[model samples]
Target: MNTMTVTKSVVMITEEASFRIKEMMEHNEEQDAFLRISVNGGGCSGLSYGMTFDQNSQENDVLDEQFGIAIIVDKEDAAILEGTKVDYKQSLMGGGFTIDNPNAIASCGCGTSFKAAARPAEEQPCE
Candidate 1:
């Protein structure tokens, strides 16, 4: 047996979110797809997290897999998303992917956008 140990990364996916994503993908029946987690300008906070499916990924996109799901984040956004957990909660109010980011210095109460430790201007670098 090979002695090299695999170093697993820590991208968090809450149980509810996993179930929801799986159901959505299976229901949609689109094989050429992935969950795109990203950050873009505009929100109650200085910046905001963007989640979508089946757009396009730049060549530099960082690919990750966790909990039987594929994740795609831009090379730059990877820094901001590190150590972050994506979760979904069906609270009576609503439900969505919650970012549990250790890097966030401040986050909006709506749980959408956040300011990183460096607080870079709302300018998302051009691809």
Candidate 2:
């Protein structure tokens, strides 16, 4: 896909979050790596969000740019992640990145896990 087409899509990355991501990239000497975002199963909430630095993009990936960073997301994951925003916050305890996903119906107390409407809860057999 063309850069212009990818740039038109919306995926927000706050300035503070961008700074931290860039810092990590610099620390690892991965200047050419892009931020890869994905959603996987097996969290307490049935799904979890994962972020990592990847040097390659798959053919089915949806590439976008935000705050000067290349963000790649799987085509399947993109549908559930639309209108998501990521930010970094510093508190008395420490600083960490936070993800706010509008499409989430539920989230675990730990904050890294979430439940989306697309993945309905399955009934477990009685013990």
TM, every model: 0.75, 0.86
* Best candidate according to lDDT: 2
In candidate 2, what residue range of length 10 has the lowest lDDT sum? Answer: 1-10
What lDDT tens digits, residue by residue, belong to model 1 across residues 31-127? 4576778778766667787777754556667776666766777768777878888888788897766678898888767666668865574633322
Candidate 2 on 1-127: residue-level lDDT in tens? 2242364444578999999999999999886788888888756677878889998888778888887888988888887888899899999999998899999998877665778897665322222
Estimate every model's Cα lDDT from 0 to 1.
0.69, 0.80
Task: Please identify model 2 stretches exceeding 4 Å from their true place.
Answer: 1-7, 121-127
Question: Clashes in model 2: which pairs?
Answer: none
